[model samples]
Target: MEQANIQMTEPGVSRADLAKLLAQALGNEKASDVVQKAASKLGIRRDPLDKGQALSVLEQIAQTPGLVGITARFAKSRLHLR
Candidate 1:
């Protein structure tokens, strides 16, 4: 991805919470899947995203249909760390 070096602030939401929010937003059991896909797309072969990777993943997610506003709200707010 061209935006590989994105920088990110650690959010206040934990993995579970983030998944919960994403599940709610997407209305399915695919929040974690989304994260994984983004991570894979970014070529991240590890658990617990580094700050930049997290932002990059979120940025990718934001581009999905119906997710811009939801992701904006999440990105705008502090997410809890797991």
Candidate 2:
């Protein structure tokens, strides 16, 4: 499988949006837990409302084992590294 290459941009979905989407995709209960786990691993606070912080959380999730399968669609076309 190909790895996702997400990019940061001004007119893209925010971290909160991404979290909510992930939650919906993974079912309600697992969503928050997943976000928390990803955030903790990324050294970001467990607040989905902060976009910048949430990006770090997403990055961490992207690096995790089996996470690519869970969040591949979300990871697509959303992140751009400098």
Candidate 3:
């Protein structure tokens, strides 16, 4: 199974939601690339909200250039917005 698929099996958050968050935060095309890069740097698969790694991955993404626009508040509000 894909890493994202495995991560999505639990609950709470879904891979699609995580992807949407990244896409919105970083902008679609860029977000896709940024997520892949962040995943590699974190030594984790491209599963942003994977178990215990979610927050850490998000933190790393937030530190990336141009991603400061993505705030914790925005992430929290995402579910409600959907």
Considering TM-score, which of the candidate structures 1 and 2 is the better prediction for this target? Answer: 1
Q: Name the top lDDT candidate.
A: 1
TM per prediction: 0.56, 0.51, 0.54
Which regions in candidate 3 have their CA more than 4 angstroms from the true location?
Answer: 1-16, 46-49, 67-73, 76-82
Residue 76's lDDT within candidate 2 is: 33
Local accuracy of candidate 1 as per-residue lDDT tens digits, 40-60? 787877556555556666767
lDDT tens digits, residue span 2-81, model 2: 98999965554445565565665566566656666766666665433354555666666666557444473465335433
Q: How many residue pairs clash in each candidate?
A: 7, 6, 0
Name the better of 2 and 3 by lDDT.
2
Could you give the C-alpha RMSD of every candidate to the true structure, in order shown? 10.1, 10.4, 8.8
For model 1, the superposed segments whose C-alpha errors exceed 4 Å read: 1-18, 80-82
Per residue, candidate 3 scores C-alpha lDDT tens digits across 1-82 of 6555454364444444555676765566665565556556888765435544555555666675554436533564554453
